[model samples]
Target: GLPPLAGFFGKLHLFWCGWQAVLYFLVSIGLLTSLFSIYYYLKIIKLLMTGRNQEITPHIRNYRKSPLRSINSIELSMIIYVIASTILGISMNSIIAIAQDTLF
Candidate 1:
């Protein structure tokens, strides 16, 4: 429902047309590509679902804290922006609406 969202819609339209279109081959290719994409999407999902049991290393640095022992304002704002954009992008038709709302 992300990158191949439009492709799925196209597939539906093609099927609705009873497969009598001149570009039936294109539809077939699209279907095959969509099928292949499922493998990749599921692979990513599987990787995310399986968590690592490794413990955090003490040597790892924490950049979230500023040198003055306070939380960094800029870093916090950027994190919020990234989170908001991701949520909005998934909820809306496309990011164009978000961009327009942000810009204008």
Candidate 2:
């Protein structure tokens, strides 16, 4: 079994590569985080609709259209920007991979 999270980070630091400096690194991380966010977004919707967290309380009804959270303009634009950047970065990665394949 793994030692602990601190030991894991220490080992990760030991293996840090030059690719960490590249723009594509952030792009890949952002893309993965975006997917994770979508998963949680679905979870929140399920919680609201099914009143999964409302069992403890009885006043709140899911029948009403109550928006407990919302996406503001800045947040919406950032999401769009991140999605576009991730797509472009993944496309660039594909091209690079193909080029590397042809070279070898």
Candidate 3:
């Protein structure tokens, strides 16, 4: 999440400079990587969803049900962190200013 957050701001700064050639190249690379990631992630999710308890190992199937209650909280926190970082990247100008000041 942090890496993506940083990348979002970096790309935003690049685009803001009106460097069309570099920006387009970087964006194309980003799109290709994103598609690759989506493909693998979806494949893993499909594999997990399609599996039956009978097909899984007995030790894994014996897992406690208590952990299920905490999954909602964990997912909620992760979602909030992602949303907050995206908002920070989009609405805050200080990050771009600092990055420009330091990197240039």
Candidate 4:
């Protein structure tokens, strides 16, 4: 995920732990892979924003016009999940403290 998302923090924490453990090679490899993944993600986002997928556009338009285009339970759940994750990411330090307190 992006900077404002949990995935970014999770990866960052993992890399930090790896560094603390002296796993330099593993950390380097992970950082390299993350960079490649970010590059692809940005490429995909650019393609989407540019509407380069001509074939899918028509299908998407048709889907939007369909009566079944109404938001379903699955979409609602996904929206809720995104909102919750964003909130959790923002409050992650508190969550880590809570977990450490419970675990220790």
Q: How high is the CA lDDT of each candidate model?
A: 0.69, 0.63, 0.69, 0.86
Candidate 3 local lDDT, 43-94, one digit each (tens): 6667689874565567767765465486665567999999998999797798
Query: Distance from true position, residue 25, model 3, in Å?
Result: 0.2
Candidate 2 lDDT, 63-99, residue by residue in tens: 4433664775657799999999889877997889899
Among all windows of ten consecutive residues in candidate 4, which has the lowest summed lDDT? 59-68
Higher-lDDT candidate of 2 and 4: 4
Q: Output the better candidate (2/3) by lDDT.
A: 3
**Index of the highest-lDDT prediction:** 4
Give the per-residue lDDT of model 1 (tens digit) for 7-101: 56766776557466667777688778878988888776775678542333444323355688555787779999999988976877666877888
CA shift at 56, candidate 2, in angstroms?
8.6
Q: What is the lDDT of candidate 2?
A: 0.63
RMSD (Cα, Å) of candidate 2?
Answer: 12.4
TM-scores, all models, native as reference = 0.40, 0.29, 0.33, 0.56
The candidates, ranked best first by TM-score, are 4, 1, 3, 2
lDDT of 4: 0.86
